[model samples]
Target: MKSQEVIFVGTRSGLRLVLDAEENIENLKRVLERRLQEAVGFYSGARVTVETRGAVVAPEWIEEVRSVLAHHGLSMDERGWDGASAGSADGGASAGREPEAPPDGAGQDQSLPGADTVLIRRSLRSGQSVSFDGNIVVMGDVNPGSEVCAAGDIVVFGALRGVAYAGANGSADARVIALRLTPTQLRIADKITRSPDDEVQAPSGPEMAYLRDGAIVIEPWTTHLGAVFGV
Candidate 1:
């Protein structure tokens, strides 16, 4: 059989399936089924993420793809849908889903490795999406309608109005942090949260997001918290 073009990119973090945004929804469904069957068992129980690469996909189409993957015992990981941390804060990970803020002056976050860093120097407007297999640091604002997804942590030096995902590969320990954190949605590993409809206020400073009791929680950030996040 001939190989499929622009299929999937497998990275250390997980599998990034380059979904065809241009194809008709039904046709795309058939193609995805066939392609997944061909590569079945090879990625047994692996974490999978679908990327349209600028193509628009309806939620129904995505559900169809997820159905196919589920048939192959591959579950869809929606944690990093341009998400960060456990909530809308620092992009880091946890074990017991307990808040793991650095205990006051614990020095550097020995857990953060230097290898997982992706730096974006520009602002991200709506409809723009950035995905990486590591941590994401945006030097500019992440405007509403934009999204950022990563397998590790996420840190935005400016406003973070978009969605952010951290630990997309199933590591609950991941966290998300932003200078001005008013995100549309936030995710860390398997947990996700959005701001309440009645809460229209924004934090005056930076914020961190992490897991707390199996849920994502966003917190006001302090210098000590920065040190724990290795900021």
Candidate 2:
């Protein structure tokens, strides 16, 4: 199989296998199975996300991919399966349904773990996205043109250049964190804000993005910041 035909990306969120849109699903599965066997144990017990973002495969074929992954010791963990996300992969939006609404006074306890959390270990490239109904932790950067949206807090251990929306379910209390907090756009619940256009670059240490009053604010990330937000 060609390298781009079936690519596997490792993220803190788990191992994401992105299948090319043009490839035949049957051929894709066979190619994937062979590749998995060759790289045995590389993705053991890892929760997997199949990215057919722009692919034509229907809901049933995704099951085939899942089965193929299961054959290679990889399967989606039930705990990490956000209710809103399943076979749908278009920027984390669920297929044919509206995102569920959060409870009243939702942001009161952002750390309550009311939903599932997903981790991606690598930086997101252009046009790639990850969405979930719970917290999302990306171990790498989120490059420009990519996006990460979550119903809860979003934590990127690396830079965030594209866009990120936290509290997607409408919790103004949701937060965004990154080693470099410069985002083209930052969103919390229903509000939206962009990074300053000043010449000053991002600070040396980590930064936190949260809602202060009616605007989004970025502050130096510290050990106790989570406590301040009840996260």
Candidate 3:
């Protein structure tokens, strides 16, 4: 089944699940397993919150659900019941602690290199703007007039003829990579560069753009270079 086939049940506030099927407990588990196998990489390391409907669910049932999810590497959290809340167990607000937001100006976690990356397996069309405060990886083409901006780096597995900005949060070390390096405008940190007005031959293989001598330069994606010097 496709990703859209998964249903998100909102029985109560703040708890939801992407369920593959809705039926008996055994059937639900089987559906979930099948879905997980279809897209294992996409769901890996993802934290999911689940909310039980108004049903008076026992702790054992919850535990069984948790076990099934955990087997597929899914983490779950429940929405606490409080006073007068419609989904509250005792018709009262949940006594659970409130959730905290990420720190202000954190933009994205640059310290944890892997945590900052986003993987998109879909093509980006015109009028689409993807802004991430960290690294971004697109396994599809970035069509013209579309924009992809990141504070860290950008890796496009397909053609890139749109606007792309890397190192948006003043990261001069950030880079922009793509299979076809043709863009309306490219920026790294504080510097900006654009394709020449004259049509140039497009490179067939992957290419990377980084800072060089206070400017942005595009280079072939090869391993011959020891280290990139000067930014």
Q: What's the ranking of the predictions by lDDT, best on top?
A: 2, 1, 3
Per-residue lDDT over 147-171 for candidate 1, one digit per residue giving the tens place of the 0 to 100 score: 8887788999999999887776556
| Worst ten in a row by lDDT for model 3 | 98-107
Candidate 2: tens digits of C-alpha lDDT, residues 63-166: 77778888876775432223223434543333223223221122233344236789998889999989776789999999999989876789999989999988
lDDT of 3 by residue, 1-231 (tens): 444333333221211353322246677666666866875433433334443323344566567767877887656644321121244453221322222221112213215322478998998999997877578999999999998887678999999889888766455777888988898889776688888999888897888999988889898876544154321
Q: TM-score for each prediction?
A: 0.54, 0.51, 0.50
The Cα RMSD of model 2 versus the native structure comes to: 13.2
Every candidate's lDDT: 0.68, 0.69, 0.62
Off by over 4 Å in 3: 1-115, 225-231
lDDT of 2 at 135: 88
The TM-score leader among the candidates is 1
Instruction: Output the lDDT of residue 199, model 2.
Output: 72
